[model samples]
Target chain A: MLLNQFLLLSALLFAMGVYGVLTRRNGVLVLMSVELILNAVNINLVAFGAFQDNVQGDVFAIFVIAVAAAEVGVGLAMVLLMYRNRRSIDFTEVDLMKG
Target chain B: MTSALLLAQVEFDVAQNIAFAIIAAIMLISAFKMVTTGNVVHAALYLVIVLAASAAIFILLGSDFVGATQVLVYIGAIIVLFLFGIMLTKAQLGDDDSVEKEQRSMGALVGLLLFVVMAFALIDTFGTQEIEFGNPEPIAYVAEPVDANDLPTPVREALNISANSGTVEISEAQFATLLPEVQRRVPGAEVRGNNAQIADAIFSQYIIPFEAVSVLLLAALIGAVVVARKE
Candidate 1:
């Protein structure tokens, strides 16, 4: 496959993820959308790594994956905590800081 | 006889093109479903399909190790954790009408705008540029001397053109055609597997980042436990 194909795929995925993050009110679903965004970045990194003559892109991708895991773990913990406190995880209703 | 060989190569390329089309179609459809689906559980399942297809794309790109890691890490560990999060939070799995807000149309507009911009940029920059798949000419010019005898005999046979003059001078088209055979013989050309190269690169050149990632993981583990623990 050409590089353009991979790039276009990642672009579409990233856009879809962005839309999900913007529109989804459920906290868990928002987190899942963030995962999609991260996966798109990973795809770009791995594709570049494979096309070029360096392993650094792959290394960066590994780091991205690791960071994404950590992010998801922390994000979900926070979501769970919010659910426990508010009895709901809807983004619209969790406006504790609203003045 | 040469025509027979050419026919086989054409068939292989056609097969690869078909496989890519199928995989990409699946990924795009499921990704669309993941974002637009009403059921949160169904969204998660669609995410799994997208991730699995992306992993398959990684494998097709000749990064088998990354593909496998993606499967193990993303689908195996992370998605399972997501499911746990949903289940623990008492999410209404069957009905998710409340998942989307009134801003959905605006979000779709933004998404479509972003897609158009990104796709245009990618095509404008890379429309005519083709990926040079497996040209070993640069390796002979740049790499430290490799002992042909040390390579597996079949791998040497696959790349024997480079063995004679220490540099293969094949045309780009010929090299492109020969890439799949060489990749089938060895995951990484002119050396050991890509996994080995990636490991060497991590431990040698990027050791600090490696250590940092480990520390990050440890902190995440502790943070998750503390944050989710009973008060």
Candidate 2:
């Protein structure tokens, strides 16, 4: 497969993720968007690694996956905490820091 | 060397293109649904499909280990955590259809802009460049002792080396200087499989980062526990 095809896929996924993060009211959905972005990045990394003959890209992807796991773990926990405190996970509703 | 081999390569390329197209479509559609679905649970499930398709794409890219890790970590652990979070948060899992109507058009416009910029950049940089199959050539300027046992199965087979073949130390500089002579006497050097080389890289060159990631994971685990636990 062409590298550009993978790149295009990554770009589209990233855009979708961005849209999700920007517009989604639910905090959990926001985290899912972030996961989408990260997954797109993983595709880019693995594709480049495979095409360019570099194992570093794959190694970095491993780290990315681990980090993403941790991120989602913490993110979901935060969402849970927010829900416990506010009884709602909507981003607009949880705006206590609003000036 | 024969027309049969050439035909096989062409068929392989066609198969790869078809796989890429189908997987890309699946990932894009599911990702779109993941963001736009009214039910948070359904969105998460769509994310699972997207992630699973991504893992398939990784497998197609020949990084089998990374693909497996994606499935294990992303689908198995991360999405499940998202589901648990949704359930704990009492998110309306039903088709209430109030996911998000606020700022939808603005977000889509921004996303479209970003996509255009990224697509242009990507096309400008790597237009229609296909990823070559088979093994990647060895890294330059690194002297490594190679043994048949140390070689990956594909590489060993390609090099036609026995299991007990003695170690041969070859540096990039030495290879370059002796290229013409070596080419006359021997076939090309064996290129290790992605899994083998990745293992070598992580344990050798990237060991510190690997350890650091472990520490990071531990900290995240503890931090998540502390944050989510009720007082």
lDDT against the true structure, per candidate, is 0.82, 0.84
The CA-based lDDT of model 1 is what? 0.82
Candidate 2: what's its TM-score on chain B?
0.73
Per residue, candidate 2 scores C-alpha lDDT tens digits across B185-231 of 32245545678889999999999999999999999999999999999
Off by over 4 Å in 2: B1-3, B96-102, B136-192
**Candidate 1 docking DockQ:** 0.72
True-structure lDDT of candidate 2: 0.84
Give each candidate's interface RMSD in Å. 1.2, 1.0
Give the number of the best model, judged by TM-score.
2
Specify the CAPRI tier of model 1: medium
Fnat measured on candidate 1: 0.73
Error of 1 at A87 (Å): 0.6
